[model samples]
Target: MIPIYFCHRELLGLLFKSQIVLTDPSEPPLKTVHKFMQKQLTSNVSKPLSSDVIIKSNTGIFFVETTEKLEPSPLAVCAVESASQTYPDRTIYFFMKGLTKNMTITKSSFYKAIPLLSSMENVNILPLDLEEVVQDTPLYPWYQKVNPAKEQYWKHVSSDGFRLAVIWKYGGIYMDTDIVSLKPVQEINFLAVQDYQIVNSAILGFQKHHQFLWDCMEDFVKNYRGGIWGHQGPGLVTRMIERHCGMTVFKGTEDIICRDFSILNTQRFYPVPYQTWERYFQVWNPKDSFNNSYALHLWNFMNKNNKRVIIGSNSVVENLFMKRCPRTYELIIKHASRK
Candidate 1:
């Protein structure tokens, strides 16, 4: 007899199979597998939130400052531009520790071609001046250790620390530069999950002085792993959720409520998996693509070098670029055509 709490028919079947082990101990460890499956469904039953304002005061949309010179990439431009358009009422902040030299143009045609981002009235580009923003926070020590290097390790580390510090001080939502907002987000405190197990820190929200974020920053210092790429990013987020929420498996669903925070389904932000990152650039099913998603994570950090948003391409990314950051799109096509 399966427990009534296991209402999902599929889960009920799995639990029923696990009972076989009690009769025949030689059988597979179906009970362990059932527990694993249950944990994996953590997000499956998530209650989707509506587009209603939850927190009245700390309502801001934020993006990490990019070191690329000239303008940000079309995707980066779209990330901020779309957010501004989607949530006109919310203040947007673009924070960076420092600017890149030649912060005007990159040798590459597709990268850093959008100049319109600098002029958005709602978007404030602020320097991550440690003394002013993070000097007294728990994350300041990690910030001090963030010396720039030729390797990409420091960028991730600094970003992890900077985002935590800023949000802790001033509550708001923080998005990666690659994410394109498709609609206004309503949840005031939430985290996005990318897979069945890992919670991505790419898109995060919280009120000022959220304890979960402080815990995450403390974990970052205690378990700082500069060599491990995701140690401070997704890895730290996942571990923090476990430590604070007592969660083991994330089903990448929308209804997961831990204390006052919510866990968003991967479909909400990352409809396309990383393994199939090209789908964002390919128009497979226009009607079905991102139908219910509020934003799209183009995985630009992983695909920026190879992917180019052609002017007239009917791909999903090109479409998003044309619609969300039309000015930048026009500039890129115009320049590329002239050459």
Candidate 2:
């Protein structure tokens, strides 16, 4: 049974007392009430972090979660664990916009996974304050004025903006939570190709204050479209690539070098296209070696039904988790056995 922390009357009273500005009259009242409650809950549950805690530039692996869920999905846990294990020398920072300072085993649904991720010396699970992260970047002004609740694709738009801002502030690899790291990234500055013409922003690597990233941020605000999907993410990156690197199609598996950064081939990150996302969930005969890949993007977005990773499924995804993120794999097996 779900827990009810507040009655409808109290909720109404709280909503009336709060200072949340609903810019769009068409916006649902329920969403505004929910946001107010979330803000109140976050404030009550966690204290702010000290200013001394800092993320170093050029030597970090980043993963951002824009949702308010305290418990990360199993795939997200695996993504962080695999990156932590692969890059032991470099720091792995998992920034959750909803994360609070006091979220611990007793309070979070990710009790088992949280402790496991925290045990890694190189892993740092931190809070992601959108305003603070985009402070000095081009997105700052837009972020301040934009009413996220009014945007149709606010989640994706915010994530797209946050990645560029964070990467610009402190250089490193910015990978989506669905990407499982298999090897250390060799390129100093790079973007992964999603298809022949599109360069995906799911996995990016750059140095601090890279001009390419700055230009991307500028374009993000100039061409902002909350209603259009991918307009701020892959589309923005692809446009920037066309401007900087020219229109180059991927014919072979070789990396294309621009002025300062390189555009990696599709095999390096997205070995399986989104159209074939089920290939990851299905059992393979010989099993894929993924020899040419550095990491596999699971395309979790394509899993619309939210399929469970069965223990004995022996699917490609199961195998990847078993090998790349053994600890998370074990947890999955353990939970399934209990069920």
Per-residue C-alpha lDDT of model 1 across residues 63-141, encoded as one tens digit per residue: 7763534355556667787898888777676655444211322233343332245445565543344433555677778
Residues 1-339, candidate 2: write the lDDT tens digits.
Answer: 111121121121111122223333343222111222445532343332222234566887888889887568889999998998899898887766665433323212434655566656677665667787787789889998999789988878888988898788788899999998899889999998998978899999999889999999999989988788899999999989988877657667888898989999999999899999998889955748888888999999889999767787988878878888898888755575687
As for model 1, its CA RMSD to the true structure in angstroms is 22.0
Give candidate 1's error at residue 244 in angstroms. 1.5
CA lDDT, every model vs. true structure: 0.65, 0.75
TM-score of each: 0.75, 0.82
Indicate the worst ten consecutive residues by lDDT in candidate 1: 12-21
C-alpha RMSD for every candidate: 22.0, 10.0
Clashing pairs in 2: none
